[model samples]
Target chain A: MDVSQELADYAAKHTTQVLERSQPVQVDMGLLAAFDNTPIDPSEYSSDLDAHLLQLTLTSTQALISALFALPTTPSAEHGPVIRPPVPSTILPREKPLPKPKEPTKWERFAQAKGISHKKRDKKEWDEERQEWVARWGRDGKNKQKEEEWATPVKAGMEADQDPAATARAERKARTAKNEKQHRSNLAQAAASSSASSRRTAQQARAADLERSMLVSKSATASMGKFDKSIEGEPKSRGVKRKFDENVPKAGWKGEKEGLLGVLKSVESGLGRKEKRKGETKEGEVVVRKAVRYHDREERLKAGRGGAGGGRGRGGARGRGRK
Target chain B: MRPLTDEETKAVFEKLANFIGKNLVHLIDRDEDDAYCFRLHKDRVYYLPLSMLHLATSIARPNLVSVGTCFGKFSKSGKFKLGVTSLDWLAKYAKYKVWIKPAGELPFLYGNHVVKAHLGRITEDTPEHQGVVVYNMADVPLGFGVTARSTLDTRKLDPMGIIVFHQADVGEFLRDEDTMF
Candidate 1:
């Protein structure tokens, strides 16, 4: 009738259905195997399978309802409709309050606080504090403790612990002396080498400077000669005229005239005599005159022929005559 | 040699303007007398002037012959056929197409031909409502077609302008001549 009663009834019915459906089916393994082998179409068997499933579900629902109804119901807490005895409270008593933290001192707070600026302490004060701290933990303090423990000296063959500070001081003193001696020696060697190197460099610089000057002078001399030659070769009308005048002969007195006249004169008379011979025969003279005329004519004809041939050949050969 | 018809010229100009507008990274308008300046999403502004469109058409017409080989020529009789579909593809297809940087320093290869004239800065005179980049024929790199400056400031003389006639201009500037010293 009430909402709670309705919910309980529905839950009981639903549980009974689920329990009844869960019951195992009595499937024949051999028959199922044979059915699997036959491989019936899913659609063909779906309706039949659906009917069986529906029956199984209904049976499951009935069985589930019976099982749920068999269980006893507990009374609701809020309702308090059916109370037997008052139950004891299970919660434990509250714990004691934790102790409050101590407040920090001004100095401690300042140190702990982030990004706080502090006035710089004097170096002397810092040094004093540092010295006090060092004294407490220094090698001397440690050695003193060792001395007290070993005051009853080692018996017979047992070796004693060496004082580390003394050994260290002695070793440092020896090393410092050796290093100082080597440093002075190295300084002397470096100074000697440096002076030598500087002297050598200076000498090389002088040689290079000298060589450069020599090269400059040589080039200057060469350039001066070149300048003179260029000056002589440069175009100048007056110089050209003078050189031409010296090289050329007088136009009227041709080279051919001089040579021919000299040769003719020499042939006419015996080498020394300039005049004609006294024994001149008229017949011989006439014959000589005829011969000279014939020879002159022959030479003229030969000259004309050569000129004509050259002109004809040149005209015919034109472009082909280069080779 | 004859001037193109007004209708024909306008059509050509529109084609080139559309191509350049789509391809180029528009720079800022440095003019006082411009009507509408476009500001590209990138910091540059483009000043579109009627005069620039005309110049772009004139330069682009001569290159059309080459454009035709790839994208068939426009019908003499008016017909609805698109020119080269893609400027990027046309650049690769065309043998003599020139690539130019519309602004900033001209590559060293351009030398004197690379014009370096300052167009005025963007101000009250040039109101950039629509994002556009302003570029001039001078800004185009060597071998690229020339376009008119949208701004009137460059209508007169620009002294810093250098025109490199050929690739050799850069070599001449570099002076590859051997020196004894």
Candidate 2:
């Protein structure tokens, strides 16, 4: 919209010029003869105090902008004393163009494109701790409170019935803290009162600790070397695998020439017989046994239950094979 | 893990069917075609392509473990290795078996011997070619093994010879650390 042009058009349409019969101007020379013309000093005008009156003809928007910037007055080429109308800002268009409309933000554009008109980008959510609305997302400026909370050491929750080890640890920690506090108080009291006795007790405690540690540090005081290996229960030695001779038979196994029967009989008797002379030598020829099939598989599959016609095939006399 | 979808369930069933047909088909008799049934492990349910169930009176192994998705798990390895609970089951079904007495268990688990004579009863049906379970006298499967020699050839051979090659043991799972020297 051309705001200036619209204002001018509205003014032109509404305003009416009064035109009556025009005559020559009459000067009042009789009043000027008694009145003296006095010139005001130009130096008397203060830049801070002086303001050019806005014309009634200009639009309110234009008048406001001109007054705000104190539009500079330049002398016209022909007129030395008269100030020319202020030059328009570079922001004004060279040619006619539409007025600059307010641009929407990125979130506003996204919301608009997505058809979500109700989204308010600057709206805040509730914060319980602060007891007021604060920005909870995206570049929160106030994080000191959260940082302070983080810096603090959180206490662990204690169970109603404390475990033995946990209670022991707690007791130890408490005792150590109490000792440290007592030591600190003792040092402070000593320093305040300038007493020398506190230092003596501390030295005595240190000497006692050193003596106890030295006694405890003695190497292998409870030596088992003085006792016999038998009394020491096998001497805690790692057991090696049983040595193999390959020619000699293992504990329950028989010699290669002794045969499987000898080994089996020996195993039954729970003895590892070294010589083959003790076992009986079978004089008869050895026979290798093949797998004993109790029933023929094909026959079993076809008609093992006396199904009529198994020997007669699938189409024999019924019940003729068996009673 | 989320329940497998219908397609996944179907796929699981198909895989299961293929496994059963590969492993248990030769063991059961021809008339007893439908000898076993099991639920295919899928997140969701689907129709099973069961080969056998109605034909056999009972399942082949009642205490079969389920393995799915996790690779190298017992049943998921795709090679069916049955854990033996019944000695009767092993004697009746496995084409070959090597029975060991209690005395030889230590040497066997120590990876020392496969066919040590004094161990216990050994089966002659074993042709010594394929994977087989080594069973103790108590019928407990101690380890998995592969037969080292042909059944006909092994009889003439020495009894102290290594008849079975040790593959894996139950104790190996307990502690895999190297034994003390």
Candidate 3:
């Protein structure tokens, strides 16, 4: 047991750790071959330096001598610049800009003439035959046509605001449009209110317009014709059939079979009789007026064009013989 | 004003369909089927259904491309040519995206081929050879691209090789074509 303990202790104590020794170490010259400490001769170095210098001198001498000898032939101080005869002056020497682009040759012009043009798209052609402007795309747009028709007219309303005549025409046009619209809306509103109301009001409106027009024509005719004020309340001879006078207000007169002729004849007969008029004078009379306004609309429009050619003798020779 | 012929109307309808898939059935008001009004250079105009510009504005907020536009252009002949602007607007919602790193921004913007290593990341599941948006690291879209490599191999890619075609880039706006790379 004791021996084991001693062996264990010895094993524990026995370690690979080295002890630090503070003693100075000595070197022996005889133990190892001595290295010579003396410096080597500088001849190799000097010879290498001489060789480098000689090489430099030879290269410099060859290059410098050649350069000096060839100086006369090469571009030197006396020569201004390397004149490149082939090239014209460039920006470097501040010469004029290169020649302006040359005109296209004949063949080029031909090719261009034959080339398709993009200008067609922007062109607006006046179709004089159709009396309208034709556009490049999709039959000159409908919207543009509409604006031209409707909006241009409105702009005309603005264009001649300063000219009294034009302004008056514009105002009349506006008034006409407003009146038409108002009448339409009133009708609509009435119809919405009640069908009977709408019908009655429309009938009234038509009657009012007819009566006003007839009265206006009668006054105009009386003023033009030889209306004797002395016989205003007297009857004419019953057997004497009145002659048709063309001098009467022909301004609004149409054929006897059409328009207000029958009513006018009846009213005039009453006026001549000097009796209390009661036939067509009822306030609520339907009094529908049908004027035979016959003409091809296109022809009428064409005829009215160019501000010329209309039956313009409305202020007729007031029976020049009678005058 | 010239009312559109049946053929021209049909052509315009086809164009609108191709441009927006004709899917905006909600935008069509049958009564006022006069939405596609076009004012022409010659002071001519007409109305048709589908006011695409109005619809785009209501939907696009202030991000309208070619601002104040209605999402269609006109040919010289006055025909409506649609969809050039719609493509750019729709690219933002596209799934395939390549985010370029900051170091590669200039090259990418200059219409250079986007190298795989220079990309920060490619969104997962992006298909190869499909159109994609090229985005900077800040997540702002630079322009469009065609993916040249698969999304899976984005990390381990052949060095200095192209990853996507710089189809259209911000460089078109940043610098002139002559000065750009």
Worst 10 residues of 3 chain A by lDDT: A25-34
Candidate 3 local Cα displacement, residue A192, angstroms = 42
Best by TM-score: 3
Decoy 2 TM-score against native? 0.23
For model 1, the superposed segments whose C-alpha errors exceed 4 Å read: A1-192, A195-201, A222-323, B1-181
Question: What is the lDDT ranking, best to worst?
Answer: 3, 2, 1
lDDT of each: 0.36, 0.44, 0.48
| Candidate 3 Cα errors over 4 Å, as ranges | A1-323, B1-88, B153-156, B174-181
Model 1, global lDDT = 0.36
CAPRI-style docking class of model 1 based on DockQ: incorrect
lDDT of 1 by residue, B38-73 (tens): 111111112233244334345443342221111112
Candidate 1's residue-wise lDDT over A12-109, tens digit each?
A: 88753321223242322222211112233466358688665554555544544444444455678887443232233334466988655544444445
RMSD to truth, every model: 42.5, 39.2, 49.2
Q: Relative to the unseen true structure, what is the C-alpha lDDT of residue B28 in candidate 3, on a scale of 0 to 100?
A: 30
Candidate 1 vs candidate 2, lDDT winner: 2
lDDT of 3 by residue, B1-181 (tens): 2223333434444443322222323223223444333211122222322344345335432353232223344456757543223335434355567788999998887768898768887877554565677778887877666777666645567879888876666666556445321
